[model samples]
Target: MQFDNIRGFLFDLDGVITDTAALHAKAWAGICQRLGIPWTDALAEGTKGVSRMDSLEVILKSVNRQDEFTMAQKAQMATEKNDRYQELITHLTASDILPGMKDFITDLKQHNYQLALASASRNAPTVLKYLGLSDVFPKIVDPSNLTKGKPDPEIYQHAAALLNLEPGQCIGVEDAPAGVASIKAAGAIAVGIGDAHDLAQADVVFPGTASLTLTALRGKLEDGVLNA
Candidate 1:
């Protein structure tokens, strides 16, 4: 909205820029099946916008199995899931980028807005490369060393810092509640790309990437502030 003060943009990887959310779900489903954990849409949704380990914990705790695995076992499971996810993403191409996202990025760059990837995925760079967007976002927040993930402001804050901008000067685009919460916690505008009711906390909500445009975003502002 308005975005007069926004100098940069922080983006999540999965549902925001690409359709890899389905790939991630498929990987997790494989893990669940192997572990005999009942998989459901609710469990899959819980993994959105979170780190791999956090998602694993979510699945484990769903059935009171969190304490069953040792650190090494959990690590192995995570690795397996990532391996599957990576294999699934091997077919990705520029055509897989969400509708209108590339154009939106171009518009933002044309307007001199800095951008960075703030995804929880450690494979963010690889995914970007596959999408032919490696140069589009040179600064991707390193998830490996982050002390906290989405729903904590650390990742968004780190992304803003990478751009040499304050959190309030950036817009965070997310398709999950955790990511929206993180952006809001970081004192940035939260732009949700999903169901309005699901992302009720966002400063503004759009149904999908196809609706993400500077003019449309600005039109959502009321007195220079976003109207959710």
Candidate 2:
């Protein structure tokens, strides 16, 4: 399906541009260990594309301890997890950027497409700076002071607004189901980067970043080849 009307692009950070999801999983596991909660890869996957506190709530729910923790306690735990994630992300370099991401971004820039980041990570700025991509995205809609997270659509809507474009004029790229849902809810074309089953709600799904090409994307958009 083509989205020839698309004028801008909104991207989710972790799995889309880099591989920081594992770092987040590790930090969350450490927090679970300290809290004496059972953690697994499945549980870690639940946190993808969500805010720190939201992820904490999911973790607490998994262990049936959500009702037991006071708001203050939950906040403290979230802070602890963020601290750990922050430390781990400090080790990230441009080398951590996913294959084909840099070239794709450069191509988009050369084509004069507006680029914005719509990630749930509050540490997005730090990671972008570490990757030397601080200036690539002129606008970033992060979790700081955000009340609603994906699959809420507020982040993507905000990103489109910041780009001075309507949601329908932007293509939102994500690797998480929640993010795909969010973008679709925002009336934007969702280009998902993950397993087909995981991103069935998206307008189109690609196996990975390396397989996506600017020419193909443009053709899809211009040719109106999208699924209804």
Candidate 3:
């Protein structure tokens, strides 16, 4: 359970770094309402850590309407959702950063641990800029170039590659189950920042960003609390 070889950190942007997941859900809800589709909690959860088109497919499949839209129409819908999301994120500021996140990131940097972003959101750089964290992540995996999203391990693998490290030499932090799965599948230690029950697959689950600390995480790993 010891992560002595861990030298890099891969982060998810939405729920892990900020509360933008709510904005994403709101935008998706608007899309569902426009399409006459029901927006349930399950549908919202299904979209977490997934790409925009993949999320749209999930929403369409919920009511068996996946085949009703052409690729061009879907593209337009995705663009509309992005527009709504952009509007919502305009209110973001440094205060939007989750508690303890800045300190933890600084701690990581001071320790010489490389950092990169592995977000499914294509607007990650903009979000980081709004949060006054434009320089924190030097390498951000571009979602547009990825052939697969979270739960497929491709994004995390690419993130590790960007850091010039093996997946086993990094820790991936996420707030979604699919993201945790991707990290684990990529052979990295998975750290969850949400409900423990929901992210049971993670190596260690902290309730929130405030609880994420290097000392505490190492303690957990040293104590062999791999699934806690």
Candidate 4:
């Protein structure tokens, strides 16, 4: 599981690196309820970290409400949720940034590790910029451009290429099962940051980022922890 070959890191935006998922789930659930659709737990979870349109598609299919929603209604509902999402995210402060993300990014940069933001969230750029981590990752592959969402390799592959590294030469850090699958599918080693039930595809499972400092991560990397 050592990552001695790792030249860069590919990171998922939501949950792993940010707290936007709860907001999104709340918004999606509200929209579904308001539209008279049953917002089931499985439906909300399956759509986590996915794009707005794709999330809607999954939710609709889950509730068997695809037949109930017209294309126009779907668009309006997505817009409504996104509007609320935007408003909610705009309220984010530095306190909202995860415990050690800023220091982790700073340490990584100082160590010359290439960084990339590979998020299924379409709102990634604005949120990252707002959180002041925008400049940390020079490469980003957001949800809008991916042909297939998470559980698909396109986003991770695209992200590695954008970062100018081979999938084998980079490590993908993710929280969701779909993101882990995407990383493995892209030929990268997946490091699960939380909730192994959703991240069986990952190579390493770490409970939380509190103990995931750069020194600790580098220790694991040197010990052959990631792709060993």
Name the TM-score of candidate 1.
0.97
The C-alpha stretches of model 3 lying farther than 4 A from their native spots are: none
Q: Write the per-residue lDDT of candidate 2 for residues 67-159, one digit (tens) a residue.
A: 998999999999999899999999999999999999999998998899999999989999999999999986998567578989998999999
User: Deviation in angstroms for 74 in model 4?
Assistant: 1.6
Taken over the whole model, the C-alpha lDDT of each candidate is 0.93, 0.89, 0.93, 0.81
Q: Candidate 1, residue 63: CA error in Å?
A: 0.7
lDDT-sorted candidate list, best first: 3, 1, 2, 4
Between the candidate structures 2 and 4, which one is better when assessed by TM-score? 2
What tens-digit string does per-residue lDDT give for candidate 1 at 126-164? 999999999999999999979998899999999999999
Per-residue lDDT over 1-228 for candidate 3, one digit per residue giving the tens place of the 0 to 100 score: 656888999999988889897899999999999989989999989998899999999999999999998999999999999999999998899999999999899999999999999999999999999999989997999998899888999999999999999999999999999999999999999999989999999999999999999889889988988775
TM-score, per-candidate, Cα-based: 0.97, 0.96, 0.97, 0.91
Candidate 4 lDDT for residue 134: 78
Clashing pairs in 4: 1-224, 1-225, 1-226, 1-227, 1-228, 2-224, 2-225, 2-228, 177-198
**Candidate 3 lDDT score at position 192:** 94
List of clashing residue pairs for candidate 2: 1-225, 1-226, 2-220, 2-221, 2-224, 2-225, 2-226, 3-221, 4-221
Each candidate's number of clashing pairs is: 0, 9, 0, 9
- Residue 6 in model 2: lDDT: 71
